[model samples]
Target: MTSSVPVLMYHYISRWKNPIAVSPELFEEHCAAMARNGWRGIGLDDAENFFIQGKPLPDKSILITFDDGFLDNYVYAYPILEKYGHKGTIFAVTGKIEPAAAPRNTLKQVWNNECSADALPRVDQPYVKHELGFDERQDPFLNWEEARLMEKSGVMRVSCHSAWHKSVFISPEYDGFYQPEKRTRTFDRIDSDIIWGLPRFKALPRLANRAFIPSQRLLAAIRELVPQETDAAYAFFAEEANLERLKTLVQGFSKDELGSYEDSMSLQGALRQELSQAKTTIEEELGRPERSLCWPWGAFSPDALSIGKDLGFRCFFTTEMGPNPAGCASRIHRFKAKDKPASWMMMRLQIYSRPWLAKLYSSIRL
Candidate 1:
């Protein structure tokens, strides 16, 4: 049996309160406690050696990672790691740090750089700019200056989370959650896409296999919900690719044609483009190996993994909680630590990071 090495994940390191937002004071305490106990914090290579190569990590060894590249990471997490003589990895949303730099953008924010990463912006979960609502914009992300400084200082190594960290797949509707925050923003640019997107998108053929969705009726309901989509988009449906594409499923289509199948397909290209660009940008900017990819939203499809692997990304990280044994690179499991005492964190980690213990705990969690 292989040793179960624990990889800890954290999001925000700020005073501002939200789920998964760990405060600076508590973060520092956690790091300091680990340091005092002679725990060794290792890098991505160390984990790869243990999990992929079947080599052993040092006893009391741990790997710490931060997701979404929030400025609070630079402002607080970076400094803490440095103070304790430990190192961690940051899987960043390269696009949120600089919106205009990417080739493709799903959402545009009048990015405010004047604010520092430590200022505690009012950002909530799913911290990427493209996934966020326009009104949720805040100045809580790290700029190049800060990220470069940390990279130079050797406190943390940077890797790509996504170019935009966009939630391209695993939409709310797909999972049957229907949460607004989890709604797909793929067609967000087009007014009609946003005005009447979800109900119409629900009619896509791929999703039809999951459950019995009344496609014609759902399209009809969208017409009533936003009559303008019907009036504006209806006339072109007969001649457009959308009608032909949707005709394979849900025949007798008496509802407003969902605008442009081309538009929806275009969104997928944006996701792949972001994945590729994030690798390129990180390599160009930080001079680090863009070999690792932590899936944004912990969302991965066979297609997503194939795309990343094709691009030379060998190490994959995900939010799926459990101990991953050797040779589990493509679906490496990680769990987040809360804003609690170091002992509290360690206890939770012991329960979740060990395979048998995690299974036992999961069985009794209810």
Candidate 2:
């Protein structure tokens, strides 16, 4: 029987209690358990060969991946992996990674006795808070220097997540109003400068949605209608009656003033530009060919997949849960790493590594 590999996906290794965040302490526990149980972490090259060419991988072989390339990965996850002799890949948003003057503190320094564990950077600090508006928020991503350091260490590899990791307005249908309290995704089509109180439209991740661009006149008219005071704007949008009024106003706009969706060709070109830029930027910066891509929010279209292949992405990771057997590179399945104990995680790894068990489990759960 051909052996299957389990790809475990993670986002933030932080103290933050979110769906995507696993605490650093628990992450170390997971790594320690993997090493203790004789499981070896494999890289993308090995994964590609095993999945694409039916090449055999070592017993108990697994692929570990982190999405978004958060600074917390360097601060917490990297040292733990190094300690456990495991390899992982970070699918980074190329646009978020900026150049840094020098490398920031990481758990490596504490592990080497150069600094106390308490002195290491924390994810909850003001500078790294993601809740703040984009311009007001300090970058929470791994800088180029940090990424390079990790790549040079042989324990981590950087791949493409996307250029912007943004979502675009898919329809002009107003869903709500954009308030800081309601902002979930890090990037969006709306301008950052126009913070708070913009019309929230139906949106999907950039690669997944054909962008709906409103005419300048329509946008200007809407902005003119918005209350200038922040509290008033929030109160105005909060009323269901106001929403109906806004909808009526929007409905009054001519077809030309409302907006237009990106044509098929235009969407393809945009996808190409966004993805190619990421591929090229990562290659140029890291000095290696980036052949792996993890779609942002695990949202991608047929056009996205086709464009990704043309740009040389060989392995495409999705959020779907399943066992990855030989010859499944285009639709690689991954199970999310949750905030759980090492034993719990290892049990999942066991199930995912076996095709039959994984199928049965997924079926029963679904």
Candidate 3:
């Protein structure tokens, strides 16, 4: 039988109790199960050769990936992977990862008796806490020092998840007002300046949408018109009567006062710039060529794929679910690692390792 690898995608190995997060205890259990079952974790390069070049990986080989470069991956996930002798890849937003003088304390330090487990930093801090402020909002992401330590340990590889990992307004159509609560949630996914503007506009992931450059004059006018108080603003937009008022206000603006959308050329150029900058930053900081990219929010277009290929990205991870068989390099499919028991994860791994079974299961599930 031809060899196929199942790619498992994870976001935060934290106790934050979110859909995108798996608790540290469950993550360790998953890793331990894989290790005990004699499953080998493969990196992007190995997966590329197997899928694109028709090279065979060993039986029970899997590709493990973590998105967004959460610090928990370094603190909690890294130690467990090292203990299990499994390798993994982290697709990090290069723009968010700052340089630190030294790596932070991890569970590894606790295990080695260098520090007590209580000394480790907490990963459960929720990002939605507006009181934490913008600077403190960066606490969740991995710094370059931590990334380097993981890469050097031969247990983790850091790659690009795009430079900004943000979304852009795709149209001038106002979807809903960006309330204070919503603003805090978008800090990591949008420009700080734009977030402050509280852009009351519809948007799609940056790579997926052409940039809609809104008129600053109109934005400023809208800012002046809206209530300044957080509760008042939230309530103002929430009332059914105020919806038409907001729409009329936006309609009052002239075409020049509204916004302009990027043409095909401009959109392509933007994608190139974003992807290039990410690749350059990751290579320069990590001291190695970055050959893999996982699209932010799994949002990518044909243009994005072409640009990525031009930029020398060999593997492009997507949220598409299936087994990665031979000749499936451009859109490598991955299964989201759920916050479930080890038995559930092992069962998924077993099913996804076979192309035929994976296809059947996906079709039926869909």
Query: What TM-scores do the predictions have?
Result: 0.67, 0.87, 0.88
Q: Pick the candidate with the highest TM-score.
A: 3
Each model's lDDT comes to 0.62, 0.81, 0.81
State the number of backbone clashes in model 2. Answer: 1
Off by over 4 Å in 2: 125-139, 179-184, 187-197, 223-251, 254-257
lDDT of 1 by residue, 1-366 (tens): 336767788988877676778988898889888888776578777777776677876666778899988766765677678778888988887877753231221011112454444443343333344333322234456666666766777778878887765322222132221113323332132112233323433422221112122344545654453334433443334344654433433333333342223344554554467678989998888766778888877876665677788888888898877766667787777777898889987686566557788666645753
Candidate 3, residue 233: lDDT: 69
Relative to the unseen true structure, what is the C-alpha lDDT of residue 78 in candidate 3, on a scale of 0 to 100? 92
TM-score-best of 2 and 3: 3
Residue pairs in collision within model 1: 71-142
What's each prediction's clash count? Answer: 1, 1, 0
